[model samples]
Target: MLRYQWEDAVRFWNSKKGEDSERVGISSRQKQKFTHTAGSRSFASVAEAEEVKSGQKVGRLQLFEITHRKKDGSPMTSEAGEIMEKLKDKKAEYEATASTDSSVNLENIDNRIITEVLGPERYSRVRFQGSGVTLTQYFGSGSQQYMPSGSQAKAEVQRLRDQMAQMQANTVE
Candidate 1:
């Protein structure tokens, strides 16, 4: 999968042998292929990209990107708490408007892994979001209910999906 700002947008294709080889180290050939594939994408120019394993439990390296809107800002901090806070209110109208005018538009897309893959339990405990960004855009609110991984998880994810879709739809051209 190729993720841009946490959105799963593109599909990555690689040979099984290539995938296996990357477990040890990426070959020059593989590197070239990755560069070519990533470079050809629409988000290639502005989005910072990295190779992420499928899940915390999985090891298949996949592409994930984070678009930087402000060139003046320093690289994102690596601290987990800071990352969560940075991502806390990125969707605010003022922030979004400021970002859209920049050379690189900053967009934090809907990420289903927070529910479908990680489930609510793991999602609540995890502090990080997206890949390659120095800071994350979303914080874990922590679980309120006893078992967030149950139907509650699905509901939360669905709600977020709807919210994100509405936000996207309302974006000013």
Candidate 2:
């Protein structure tokens, strides 16, 4: 999906006319960074975070810093800093466990970090929104190739259920 989004962006930029005729170029590395951040909801590694921080003209260290800082460049309170530090430590612990334990799924670590950052309520909303979008996109495109309409889809599902019931009845005999 990210690849498709990247391709669509490239296509749109390349299609510009007039003064914008000089096609805008985006690097593959930038796309990779975008995909990594979007997919994992975090940077691929601390090195990648530093690389991003170096390229930023403003908001340096914003990735690791909580947003409750004052305009005077001081933390709102020591508690905010402490909380962020604890979260960072937890993230590091998860990464270490993932590295040492072959059975650890990296995606689970990402989900855990996102859930921690967003909290349970917001995290659930985000998950629901994602699922809604996925289902909408799939049915919008997939229906055109499979069942043409909602009635047909319902009919097909009913037909499958009936077939399963018939098979069960035959097996009982």
Candidate 3:
């Protein structure tokens, strides 16, 4: 995994590079901080977290901080509940639409789901949105694909659900 400085990420996103790169730096709005604490979530190891400091200009999605901690205090699972529901719906939809005439390859299935389920901004994380993917890779093709097993998938779904529940809990308070 590569360590990206928040300011550098901002510069990359803002398209201001090298000497031409504005010294003024990226605005906080354009950068997001990923931290860990109660009622918080982070998708990074302790070392990774240490590498990044708060108030640093991380990129749009370069850093993920879970707003809610698990029982063990880890990332809040990068999974999305709505996406899982949609995945179920998609599987059903595929079965329903499955036909002798219908020819759907893995790539086709993945692309369709990615396009429909995730809009432009959210679509970047193509792994969860797609049918099968190497979970390890961040939307990249690899030999050792990281497709989640049944238990792993279940855990992720549960984490997403718990996060939502926590958000709801916070909103109520």
Candidate 4:
């Protein structure tokens, strides 16, 4: 029965191999035939041609065209011109307001807001001086200390215990 099953499997594999050989497969060159035409041209030149055909501008020219022209591609009307002037004035006003708000001196900011944001302990330590504050003043000047690990830590603990024991003994005497 096992020999019959092995023979059947071998026949199935031979049939599949024969079917694959009979079928036609596309070559890599045929698959990329269309891409070869476009790829022959520089990408930028092709893109520029497409943009010009579509009535679109490139980069800063596009931005200028958009701002200057009406949405329907007609020249700006008198009413539209007035609206654009109003928008420009509003924009200038908004920028002036923003500049004034941002230019406020740090010293002019209320202590209450600073205290609330920083919390009491941090606020006390970080009280801003006009000359400029150093990070060391706010968070200690000490560098991070290395801690012993494993056997070293155990030895250190034992040494500390021995010193404490000696001190206790002396106090008792």
Q: What is the TM-score of each predicted model, taking all chains together?
A: 0.19, 0.31, 0.27, 0.20
lDDT of 2 by residue, 73-168 (tens): 555556555555666776786677557654444543433554465444332233322223342342344424322245544644665698799999
lDDT of 4 by residue, 1-173 (tens): 69999898778658977456445343544443112122354434544665688877443223223344555665355543443354455445435533655432232122322333333333233333212344355344731211123554465466569879999999999
lDDT tens digits, residue span 1-173, model 3? 24567776766767745435454344542353322243222333432443465645432122222222355645443343345456557656655544422332233344444445544324234422222323335434651232434654465466569879999999999
The worst-scoring run of ten residues by lDDT in candidate 4 lies at: 104-113
Worst 10 residues of 3 by lDDT: 59-68
Report the alpha-carbon TM-score of model 2 versus the true structure.
0.31
Candidate of highest lDDT: 2
In candidate 4, residue 89 scores what lDDT? 56
Candidate No. with top TM-score: 2
Record all residue pairs in model 1 with backbone atoms less than 3 Å apart, i.e. clashing. 76-134, 87-137
What are the lDDT figures for the candidates, one per model?
A: 0.35, 0.47, 0.43, 0.43
**Local lDDT at 133 for model 1:** 26
Error in Å for residue 5 of model 2: 46
Off by over 4 Å in 3: 1-79, 103-106, 121-173
Model 1, backbone clash pairs (residues 3+ apart or across chains), number = 2
For model 1, residues 1-173, the per-residue Cα lDDT tens digits are: 33573352222225566566666475555443112122334442322333232323211111121322123443233332233333344334324543543422222222322233323424233312333322122333432322334554465466569879999989954
Report per-prediction Cα RMSD to one decimal.
18.1, 19.9, 16.6, 29.1
lDDT score, candidate 1, position 126: 30
